[model samples]
Target chain A: MFYAWPFATLLGRVLQPSSVVDTLTSPGIGRVIWFTCWQALVSTALTMAIGFAPAYVVARYRFRGRRAALAIITVPFMLPTVVVGAAFLALLPERWHGTAAAVVVAHVFFNVAVVVRLVGAMWAVLPTDLTAVARTLGASPARVLRHVVLPLLRPALYAAASVVFIFTFTSFGAVKLLGGPSHPTIEVEIARRATQLGDIDAAAVLSIAQLIVLAVVVWWSARWQRRSEHTFAAGRTTRRPRTRSERRVVAVVMATTVAAMVAPIAMMVARSFRTSSGWSLTPWRTLGANEVRPGISLGVDPLGSLAVSLRYAALATAISIVFGGLAALTIASARRHGRLLDTGLLLPLGTSAVTIGLGMLITFDTAPFDWRSAWWLPPIGHALVAIPFVVRSLLPTLRSISADQRLAAVTLGASPLRAWWEVEVRRLPGPLLSAAGFAAAISLGEFGATTFLTRSGRDSMPIAIDRLLGRAGAVPHAQAFALATMLFVLTAAVVAIADRQEVVDARRA
Target chain B: MLDVRDVSLSFGGPPVLQRAALQVPTGDVVALLGPSGAGKSSLLRVIAGLLVPDSGSVWLDGSDVTHVPPHQRRIGLMFQNEQLFPHLDVAANIGFGLRMQRTDRATIASTVEELLAVVGLHGFGPRRVTHLSGGEAKRVALARALAPRPAVLLLDEPLTGLDRELHDRLALDLAGILRATATTAVLVTHDHDEAATIADRTVVLGADMT
Candidate 1:
């Protein structure tokens, strides 16, 4: 439903010979495409550069509060883009807001966590002995890094860069807020053409172009990452910093990462409480009031929007849990096409959410199936982007159960289903809860499709935040910041609790 | 020459190696025999500069290298499981040590070819390490350890996992290679036949033995 219907709708329009030439010839479209590629490249480079030291520190050294630091850094990756936009808006001076620099910074804030996680996971497993062996052969530390460590980490680096690139390339909400008027990405351009200009053909052409690029990048990254995906037996036995310089590096990296991740959200929270005289809770207290901004009346009640978002997230969680769990089970048992099915499941994550929204708009607007006004449409849209997370989280945990355990159960007179239930399902609550937490987090902060489907007064949390930030009043801005802080705390708490539970389970196991 | 003095070590339990001392003259192969959990591998790790002893020092050629990092110690260790680099082919694995020393491409190629020949795997250089049989992989690992030509080579149960016939064959090959290189070496093993076949002298390590 996510990729097929969207591509089919896009191809229907793109197949026209005039559409391609028209989209390519439009000077504005050409510029949007160029700027999108340039920013994505630069943002991916910056994210990789900023994330490397921290990832190395986390993976190679054991320090006090290291695990907590990892969990905290991951919060930004799960945050709503509008919240991140609000964070930068609150943190940066007025002169720096709504610029290309702001957009790039926000992109880095959102994506650096990905590089840290992917590269750090790989860096941890790599036996320290390989480098030790190289050193014994007269290689210096720098030489060992170049000849031994870099070659080994190249695949993970490629994968991280690819994911960050795709994310920045398809960015919408942050680009909408932080990019101002002069800088529009392909996704931003697609949203404008589809919603504002009603230029469906141009949107379709751009969607196709973005999908083609995304597919190629994802495929190449997967090819490289597959080489590094071996089951590592030797666990990460981290040690404390052994030298003064080592201690300094760890301190600096950890300090910078914590500040970079935390300060923006902190500023947002602070801004929520700031009034003309001093800090107060007036903005939060007025969440239920419909405030007027100059001549315009903003009718949204922040609490109502929060409730709507919670309901949508709950519905999305249910849908994804059922579908993703069944998909994981099928893939685990499948002897053929499993890889293809896995890739298919992940296609929605790589494709632009704007394209999927437009696809749903056009495809579901006719006869008895007019879901344009349905409350369930947004949750379904959220599910399309969320099921992959569910499957990815559950599939690995499910696959990790050795088949011998099930075989042993069956040999003791249990049926196959009963054996699987006893050996696998009994061990699944931890991962399933983690998957649900991830799905709920994604649903709560989902903005791209919600922006398309939501009505003015019945907006979800992210859409409401985006709308609040768009208006011209201190009240709207404060409400947006307060709401963003709320979303941040909610999502962070979910993800942190999930991670903590997983860690506790790991210790027990 | 290698010397280990009073190298007692433990992991918060009963000592694995207590007041252990050994000396090997230049160009001699000495085997340390012990049962499982008898600290034979732990002792080898200490000598190879991978582990630091609690109250002893290690000397190589009359210089105390106890505090030297493993890489700077110039000691070669082939693990019991034959820890070949899975990402590299047989040829690259054999030449990994030389490459780390920044040896030129031509010399690395020749040295890898020679080592492969020494291990009787000349034609198998291009094969993936993962594709190799267990015995073949062990040979590649041996070649990699020998390629650096370190001062002291430590072999930890290099023949333990092989079949009986292959073990006997590789023991003879290993003996010939040691004699040909005149390499100062320490072999850790529990099998008495393996120790007798590979070493000039044997040292037994156990709670009852001093």
Candidate 2:
């Protein structure tokens, strides 16, 4: 809808032969598309390289500090892209400023969690019996990995790759902050045209193109996943003693993962506390101060932005629980003709957030659904993006509920509704709570699409930090550092709480 | 009485059972003994209404129940794993079937208490299933399946995971429980001794049972 009128106008203008030729032969658009693909591919490969060995180690071995390593790998995934970009900026040498390598490195740093969590979790569940059988048949360790492990791991690996590709393909903040003019991704181009040039037509075209690319990638990945079929034996023992080679591999993987995961975060922490005079608490103190600008009477307060962020996060979490819970229940109960509904629920996870924000802008900016002027748009947008995660986390637990319990209840003379309540609904507390916690964390850090929907003076934490970083001053930069630190701590707390709940549930099971 | 006539079942690409027939009179404990791959479990599943036979008819008490779901058919199934709800306590597990039937709280509590006594698990209601020893868990699973008062009970290798002493004792106890309750059951197992001890009649199954 955002592009309808502009496209029509362009079509009208291109009715002339000369204009039509120009439109068909634009070099700038082609360059943007080429650069977008290049950067996304490189970022995905680098992320997998950094994440795969560690994930393999975690899945295959039992060692000290495994839990801590997993936590560190997942922390970046929960962080807002703007915060991660800011951390990278603070950490990278100023000499390598405005380079493609910087953007690729930042993308890798942010996406390591995706590869580890998705691939590593599935790898851990592969049956040990398959490997044992292959070894007993005299297959070498490397051969077993190639023939036995890789075949089974293919589906999960492809799924993780598809996810990482979509995220990098929609690269916005990291590329904008770190990329040179020669390496602008399509997402960065879209943002620039919409915000700086106000070329809504160009931005819409780029967004539509991005959506098409993502759809193709997702389709290909789904096809690959469906064709690969192998089921492992259940109830295989997972706690095997590690051999010497396994021990060395695990140790090396752990060291590399820890270094890659912790370096940028350590850099951010150091920068937050550093001062010209000495290491000081000036940044922390300035978090509450409001510095007035030249010729402007009012100054934006960092604390005020923080409060708005908290309010939005809370609201988004509540909305996600309500809407996402309904969607999950519908999928769980729709015994027949449920495949379409399930696919619809998962569609948001693959679509780019920026494209969704653009659609919302086009659909709701006027007429019967004029939500542009309302304060609810940002939270609603965040909820739409967070629903997919909630569904993914809850669906597995729901599916695993045994059929006997429900039947047992019904045969005992209970009505169907009563049986459902007693058997399934009563057991949903663990997954629901954890999913809500994750949605809350996502809302707190979300920036990509929220940037498009947020009205003037209604900046989120990421937006406020971006504003502070853009201005040239010591106090603003310090305040931005402090805000970033606060955001980090808030997200860390949410993740830690969710992690504890998961551990408790696992122990109980 | 429960009857299965010319039942067939197949998985993804091939048939596992073809035109299998069986009958159980009321209060009869029949054992279906077979080798590992003789389709005993599949036949049991078909009778329990968990799997619909490709083409067959099922009758319970002279009523056609071929289209009924497992819950509506009033059948109880116990797996070799003692598939107790890990989240629920012993008492809760026993009362789960009754609660599903929406029995009144007073009745549920009393029935659970009676079953716990019968299983020699008095005062064990509050303990979590994960804490139970192998023998205790198997008993709890049996109590759970029996609490609902199903017309027919299905036990799939109920004693497979127990040690020899526990298995022998539980088999005897189980037979006594079935006789006391006058419940009809179909026991599926590979152990001839277990079937001999617990069943009133045993049907040996082979690859060509169909």
Candidate 3:
């Protein structure tokens, strides 16, 4: 409803049924979709291969520094795409740039965390009974995993694959930085046509096409989720003890995962602190220096942008928790499965943030609906991006509260609201706090669509870093590195807090 | 004090309890006995107002309370596991019902202490529920349920998971507590020995009830 007008009108004009049919038949569109499918498929497969062994180790064994290793593996998932791209750029040799191979490598780097976290968590909860039964049937470990474990893990694996596919399909920053002209995502094309060439019609048509593709993928994934005929007994899985060979395998996998995940970040940090002569603190010192270029300053300060980013992130987190928490509770309480409502809440996740920004820009930048000047647009944009995560984090915990407990409370003379508060709300603090922290981190690091939505002079940390990278100067580049380092530290802090809450919840359970 | 007349209930596929009727006078503990999947728990659920039977009437104190919501029925249910709120300490768990009823702080505190004494859990009020032993937790669960002075109490396999000695001791303790409160009670169990130990009258469930 918010973006109905411009989308309708623009669709009416540019996506004349005739042109859409033509674009559908065009070889370019097919090529683009084919490339997207191939990239996402390979990326998902590679992520699984690289992530599975380490995830299995973490799920099964108890060893020194295991918790720290898990935390390190998760850091890439929390970092913004642009920062990940920047880290890769800093690490890669100049000669090894602007190739499809580089883009694929970057996609794998960005998505391995998704596979590890989702699959590893699922593995942790697998019931020991299944494995015991298989062993009694005289099955080896390899045979059990192939026949029993993998079949049981289908839902999580499919979910992770769909998420990775959507992310890579709409990937903007990494491809833009690594592949340049050689590889352009539909997202990049939409941005180029809309902002650089002033072709709203073309941009609108492309955005609609992207939306259609995303809808189909999401719908397919949802169907797959419903059709997958596997449900494991809850709260029954136990960890296994590692043998010598198993221990060696676990050590090797952990070392590779950590090294792969951390090398780029290490390079980024090293770059943040280095100068031409040697290691120096010049970049950090110059982070706050305000040198105005000719006729460019519109009262925008770097420090002010930092404040704005924090303010917007805080607001977005609050909004996400309230709305997302309510939605989760409603879903949990519904007597029947709410497929439509669930899909509606999750649709924004697959739709590119830049596309959403464009949709908002087109709808709200003019007429009686004008809200471009309200200073609320950015936070609204950030909230849209964060709500899906909030729902994801809250749903599992909400669903885990047994129905019998709620009934027990009610039969004990508690009102409906009181019963819910005692039985449901009491268990929600950990997930809610963690969701809020994730939302704040997302808002802080958001760049792609934020670049399109904000005013020309106003900037967030990511946009500031992008500007510094674009300009041809030593100081600006150094400042960009410093700002990137600061953003990384901030994101790492937020994720650490969220992970701590998760640990606390695990202990309680 | 409580009467259930010709109750029939189904969960979409098949009826779990059909045309089942039972009665319990005040201060009587009626044990509902059945094997697994014989709808013993479902009967208890219906009595506690957690499930709405297809055709039935529940009378408490000569008033029809069939349509009353579970919260308004003044019934208490204790599961095999204690199901104590993990986030709350023993005192808060005991006072949970009073807090829900919006009772004053002084009354809540006094009732919690009184109930703790009855359960022989003095000075355990501030301890986390997670830290309690199996027997101690069951005692606390009983105290919490009885703190609100419910008109009826329901227990579902309360001794199913315990060893023989602990189970017998807890069963004896629970029966004594129920007698002292003069609360009409229903106890569901698969073990005939447990039912005989705790109940004043025993009713055996059959496939016809399901």
The superposed Cα distance between candidate 1 and the true structure at residue A139, in angstroms, equals: 3.0
The lDDT values for all models are 0.85, 0.77, 0.77
lDDT of 2 by residue, A1-509 (tens): 22234234333433556543443355687888887888889999988878888777777677788888888888887787877877887789976657888988998988888888887887888765445423322234565576567777888888888888888889777776677566788887777666677665566666666766888999999999877644443443344333456677877888887887788777877787776666878877767666434564224567878888898989989988888887787777684655787877666776567766766665675677787878888888888889888887887777777778789999999999999998888888888889888998888888777877887677888888877777666666666777887888898898788778888888988
Model 2 residue pairs with clashes = A409-B100, A412-B101, A413-B101, A414-B101, A414-B102
Q: Chain A TM-score for each candidate, in the given order?
A: 0.94, 0.87, 0.86
Ranking by TM-score: 1, 2, 3
* Candidate 2 wrong stretches, greater than 4 Å: A1-27, A125-144, A180-182, A234-246, A292-299, A367-369, A401-420, B1-210
Positional deviation of A471 in candidate 3, in angstroms? 2.0
Query: Per-residue lDDT for B70-181 in model 2, tens only?
Result: 6567778877777665445798778866765668999989998999999889999899777889999889988988888889888888899788999999999999999998
Chain B TM, every candidate: 0.96, 0.96, 0.95
lDDT of 1: 0.85
lDDT of 1 by residue, A76-129 (tens): 998888889899999999998768899999999999899999999888888776
Lowest summed lDDT window (length 10), candidate 1 chain A: A228-237
After superposition, candidate 1 runs with Cα above 4 Å error: A1-7, A60-66, A226-252, A292-296, A319-343, A364-371, A391-435, A496-509, B4-21, B34-43, B52-56, B62-64, B203-210
C-alpha DockQ of every model = 0.32, 0.01, 0.01
